[model samples]
Target chain A: SQQGEEDPQALSIQEGENATMNCSYKTSINNLQWYRQNSGRGLVHLILIRSNEREKHSGRLRVTLDTSKKSSSLLITASRAADTASYFCATEGPTDSWGKLQFGAGTQVVVTP
Target chain B: DVKVTQSSRYLVKRTGEKVFLECVQDMDHENMFWYRQDPGLGLRLIYFSYDVKMKEKGDIPEGYSVSREKKERFSLILESASTNQTSMYLCASSLWAGRPNEQFFGPGTRLTVL
Candidate 1:
């Protein structure tokens, strides 16, 4: 079953603009991680935010996690045409066995030049 | 660099035939996983192994089985392929279980069942 759900199923923005997406999960999680996938390819790990951490930053990617609300948001600053891809939010619940992750349907982002 | 590889990038099989999808990781990670991705369903775990010869069922295990005979290799087997089983299959490996470690994924194999 999918534990997380991403809002704004699709988003389109011009290059240099910022893109933001939100993900909400059902249960308490040990960690929330974001992944990016190009068309017809595997996913690449983007950033990870632990349950205890409120926010984290890697390059232009910023992730915020709010356990109280069971939600997380990912922000991409200065988007580029090359940044166009599908982003997914995965949650590893505290009770989840063997590091399994429940992934959301994902949000497709398109950046136009 | 950590690397994971799948046996095929594309495969076509007939329904009711036995199918095998292979995955190997060079990182020597103790944990490996198999997931199937559909159009709207992001990804669903079919099976996972924490160590050689140890397997565990994931959320959707029906019509699928797995093998991890060697530490670096994991294989997902379909006893009798069905049209619904046609999807993008992904293989991933991580350092350990119950950790904050990230998983490394292969390019994925798109299987078509007729």
Candidate 2:
């Protein structure tokens, strides 16, 4: 079974609009990481937030985590066509010593021109 | 930057035929993983290795086997291919997974079983 699940399986928006996706997990995690995948390609690491951290920012991307709710959200500011891709959230559980990330179903974001 | 490479970008195989997929990582990372990605199922872990000659079964390990004879190379084997096995295969490697351990991924292999 997957450890994390992403909501809003699909989203569409015009360029320059902000897009937000949410992820919920079931277990206690050491950290949470986000990844992006262009069509027909491998995934790229985006941002990682530790359990102790509540929020993190990288360039135009913002990620927030709420341990109390066991959820995390990714916000893409000033979205562009290039930002259109499948976004996934992965969790590293407390017992995952090998860094085997359990991934969510993913959210597909479409930034239209 | 860490570099992870897959043997083939696209491959076609027939049912009941043996198939082999190879992955190599140049960063000398200690851990490697193989996953299959599908439309609705997302990425499911098939197998992983923490060191040479050591392997572990992942979430969906049925009908699949893995080998890691060398530190830099890991191979995934499908004893006999089946149509349902067709999907995008991805390989990843990371330096001991923990704080700040980001896994580097290979481009991926699209395998079609007829």
Residue-pair clashes per prediction, in order, are 0, 0
Candidate 2 C-alpha lDDT tens digits along A1-113: 69889988999999999999999999999999999999999999999999999999999999999999999999999999999999999999889868899999899999999
Best by TM-score: 1
Question: Which residue ranges in model 1 land beyond 4 Å of their true spot?
Answer: none
Residue-by-residue lDDT tens digits, candidate 2, B31-81? 999999999788999999999999999999999999999999999999999
lDDT of 2 at B61: 95
- True-vs-predicted CA distance for residue B98, candidate 1, Å: 4.0
Lowest lDDT sum, 10 consecutive residues, model 1 chain A, at A92-101
Q: Where in model 2 is the C-alpha error above 4 Å?
A: B98-100
lDDT, each prediction: 0.94, 0.94
Query: Against the true structure, what is model 1's DockQ?
Result: 0.78
